[model samples]
Target chain A: MSILVIAEHDNAELKGATLNTIAAAKAVGGDIDVLVAGSGCGAVAEAAAKVEGVSKVLVADNAAYEHQLAENVAKLVGDLGKNYSHIMAPATTTGKNMLPRAAALLDVQPISDIIAVESPDTFKRPIYAGNVIATVQSSDAIKVASVRTTAFDPVAAEGGSAAVETVDIVDDAAVSKFVGEELAESDRPELTAARVVISGGRGMQNGENFEMLNKVADKLGAAVGASRAAVDAGFVPNDMQVGQTGKIVAPDLYIAVGISGAIQHLAGMKDSKVIVAINKDEEAPIFSVADYGLVADLFDAVPELEAKL
Target chain B: MKVLVAVKRVVDYNVKVRPKADGSDVDIANVKMSINPFCEIAVEEAVRLKEKGVVSEIVAVSMGPKQCQEQIRTALALGADRGIQVETDAELQPLAVAKCLKAIVEKEEPQLVILGKQSIDGDNNQTGQMLAALTGMGQGTFASEVNVEEGSVKVTREIDGGLQTVELQLPAVVTTDLRLNEPRYASLPNIMKAKKKPLDVTNPDELGVDIAPRTKTLKVEPPAERQAGIKVGDVAELVEKLKNEAKVI
Candidate 1:
C-alpha cells in the first residue's frame, strides 16, 4: 500500500501544518508521496523532497491551481486516485474543501479530522464538538481522510532526500472564479504553529486591551490568540479564535489570561505541553487543564509578567 | 430565485456529552436538542436574503427520525417558507445525506442551496461539498460573508491564513461559518404561525436514495482527561516551575 499526502502550501513556501500531516502519513506505514498542487510552487516541492520519510514529491504547476480551488484540485487528486491506497491532507480549510469532493468523485467515503490511526481502515476522531471521541472503520476500497495536525508531532523538515517528479495539471473548471483574498498580517508566528501562545478572553473588555497580551507575547516571542468569547465580543477578529468551532493549537507553552476556559475553548488548546492559566475566577474550567494555575487579576499579572520577561 | 437550506438537529452545544460504558455510542437518552449552530447561521443568512427580495421562496429540509420535525418547524419559525423532512430512523452518513439532498434539489430546482459547513454531531464537513459534486454544481464552503448578485453569488470564506472571496455561478452550494451572522431567536408569534406552515414528510427510499451508513462505529470512548495541577502562590513560583521543570520559557 502507498500513501499520497497533499502538501499544504503557498506558491512561495510550505505551511507548517503539512509537516504534522506528513507524520500522520508516516504512521499509516507506507511509501509516502507528497503532491504539491499550486501555481509556481516548485520551491514547495523542493522543500517537500527534503522532509524525512517522503519517497517522492509530485509537483503540478499551472494557472488553474493558482488558488488551489476545490473544483480544480479535487479533479487533480481524483484523476490520480488510482495510484495510491490512502490519500490524506492536513485538516485545514483547504484540505476540508478539496478532499471530500475528491472522495465523492472517487465514489468512496471520506473520514474527517482523524486524530489517530488504529489501522489502515479504522481511525479515531472527535465528534460533537470534541465531547465524544468515536472510533470508525471504513469499508471502502480507497481510504480518504484529513489528519488533525495538532494531534501528531511534526516530522523533521530535513534529513533524507526524495526525488521530485513533475506531473501534468488537470483541466480548469470554469464554475467558480477567485475574486481576491484578505489575509491577516502578523509579525508573530501563525497561531497553530506557534511554540508559545498567550490568549485573552471576553474579560479583556475591548479590542484595545488585547495590547496587553500582545506585549507579553512580544516579550516571549509568542503568538497572540483569543477565545470565541473574545471574538464574539468584538475584542478580536474571528480568525484569532481558539476553540472547537475555531482553530486548534497544541503549542509547547500556552498562557490563558482572563479566559474562563469553556469546554469548546478547551477542545482546541488542552493538548499544549505546559499550560498556565491566570484568571480572577478560581472556579474557571481552564484551571482543570492548566499545569500552573494562578488565581490573580489578568490586568495585574499580564503587565507584571511582561515586565519580568 | 429560490433558496434551499439544510438544517440538522443535534445535542445542544452547552451539554458535555460522554460515551456509554460499553463503548457502543454516545448516550443521548435525555439531552436538550437544538439546531446545529452553523445550520442556524445558514437559516439566518437565507432569511436575510429573502427579506432583501433576492429570494422569492425558502425551502428548508432535514433528514432524521420523526423527532427532527421539531427542528424543521424551528426552521419554519425562523423564516423558511416551507419544510421537507426526509424521515429515517437509521443513522445516515455524509454521502447518504448528500444523495438525499441531491434528490430533493432535482425536484425543487432551487437556484441556490445553502447548508451548514458541518453538523456538531459528526463534524464530517462533507455533505455540502459532496452534494455539489453529485449535482455538478459549484460550491463555496466555510462562508463568512455571502452576497447575492445578478445570476451569481460572492462568498467570503474563512480559510486558515485569512479570508478568501470567490464568485460562483447560479445553482451553486454555499455553507455557513460562525462569523457569518448572528442567528435571531424565533418570536412567540412566529413560533405560533410556524405551526400552520406546510411541512411535508418523506423517506430516502421515496427520494430514490439509500440511507444506510457508509462508515461503521467500531467503538466510542471518552478522551483522556487532563488532571488538575497545583496552584502557584505567586509569580516567582510560577516562573520557577517554567524555568526549572517545564523549561518552556
Candidate 2:
C-alpha cells in the first residue's frame, strides 16, 4: 500500500503540523510520498524531501495554485488520488478546505481529524465537542483522512534523502479567485504549532489585558490564545480562539489565565501534556484538569509568573 | 437572485451531553433541542440579505427526522420565505447530506447557498465543501464576512493563521463561522406567523439520492476524566510543580 501525504507550507518552509502529519502517515505503514503543491515552492519541496521516512516528494508548482485556492487545489489533489491507497493531510484550514472536495470528487468519504490509527481503515476521532471519542471504520476502497497534528509526534526534519519529482499542473477552473489575505503578523509561533500556549479568557476583561499574556508568552516562547468567550467579548480576534468550535491545540504545556474552563474551551486544549490553571475562582472547572492550579487574580498571578519564568 | 440556507437541529449548546450506556451515541433524549448555533448564523445572514433586497427570496432547507420541522419553523420565524424538509429518521452522513442538498440545488437553482461550517453534534465539517464539489459550484468555507455582488460573492474566511479573502462566482456555497453575525431571537409574532408559512416536505428517495452511512461508528465513549489536582498557594509553588513534577516546562 502507498500513502499520499499532502504537505502544508508557505513558499519558504513547511508547517510543523505537516511533519506531525507525516508521523501519522508513517503509522499507516506504507511507501509514503509527500506532495508539495504551490506556486514557486521549490524550497518547500526541498524541505519536505528531507523529512525522515518519506520515499518520494511530488512537487506541483503552478500559478493556478498560487493562493492554494480550494477550487484549484482540490482538483489537483483529486487528479492525483488514484495512485495511493490512503491520502492524508493535516487538519488545518487548508486541509479542511481542500480534502473533502477531493474526496467527493473521488466518490469517497473523508474521515476528518483522526487522532489515532487503529488499523489502516479504522481510526479514532473526537465527536460532540470532544466530549466523546468515536472509533470510525471506513469501508471505502480509498481511505481519505485528515490527521489531528497534535496527536502525533513530528517526524525528524533533517534525516531523509528523498527524490523530488515535478509533476504537470492542473488547469484552474476559474470558478473562484483569490482576493488577497490579511494574516496576523506575529513573531511567536502559531497557537496550534506552539510548544507552549498561554490562553486568556473573559476574565482578562479587554484586549489591553492580553498584553500581559503576551509578556508571559514572550518570556516562555509560547503562543498566545483566547477562549471563545474572550473572542466573543472582542478581547481578541476569532482567529486566536481555542475551543470546541475554534482551533483545537494540544501543546506540550497549556496555561489558562483567568479562564473559567468551560467544556467547550476544555475540548480544545485538554489534550495538552501539562495544564496549569490560574483563576480567582477555586471552583472553576479548569482546576479539575490542571496539573497545577493557582487560585489568585490573574493580574497578580500572571505578573509574578512572568517574573519567575 | 435567490438565497438558500440550510439549518440543522441539534442538542442545545448549553446542555452537557453524555454518551449512552451502550456506547452507541449521546443520550440526547429529553435534552433541549435548538438550531445549530452556526446554522442560526447562516439563517441570520440569509435573512439580512433578503431584507437588503439583494436577494428576491430566501428558502430554508433541512434534512433530518420529522421533528426537525421545528427548526424549519424557527428559520421561517427568522425570515426565510419558505422551508423544505427532507425527512429522514436515519442518521445521515455528511456526504449523503451534501448529495441531498445537491438534488435540491438542481431544482431551486439558488444563486447563493449558505450552510453552517459543521454541526455541533457530529462536527464532521464536510457537508458544505462536499456539496460544492458534487454540484460543481465554487465554495467559500468558514466565512467570517460575505459580500454579494452582481455576479459573484466576496467572502473573508477565518483560517488557522489569520483571515483569507476569496471571490466566488454566483451560485456558490458559503459555510459560516461563529463571527459572521449575531443571530436574532425569533419574536412571538414572527413565531406565530411562521406556523402559517409554507413548508414543503420530501424525502431522500424522492430526491433520488441514496442516504447511506459511509463510515460505521464502532463505539462512542466519554473521554478519560482528569482528576482534580491540588491548588498551589502562589505562582512560585505552581512553577515548582510544573518544573519538578510535570517537567513539561
Give DockQ for candidates 1 onward, in order: 0.82, 0.83
- B-chain TM-score of model 1: 0.98
Q: Which regions of candidate 1 fall more than 4 Å away from where they truly are?
A: none
- Quote the positional error of residue A140 for candidate 2 in Å: 1.1
Error of model 2, residue B228, in angstroms:
1.8
Residue A228, model 2: lDDT of 96
Worst 10 residues of 2 chain A by lDDT: A166-175
Of candidate 1 chain A, the 10-residue stretch with the lowest lDDT total is A166-175
TM-score of each model, in listed order: 0.98, 0.98
User: Best candidate per DockQ, number?
Assistant: 2
Q: Give the TM-score of candidate 1.
A: 0.98
Q: How far is each candidate from the true structure, as Cα RMSD in Å?
A: 1.1, 1.1
TM-score of chain A of each: 0.98, 0.98
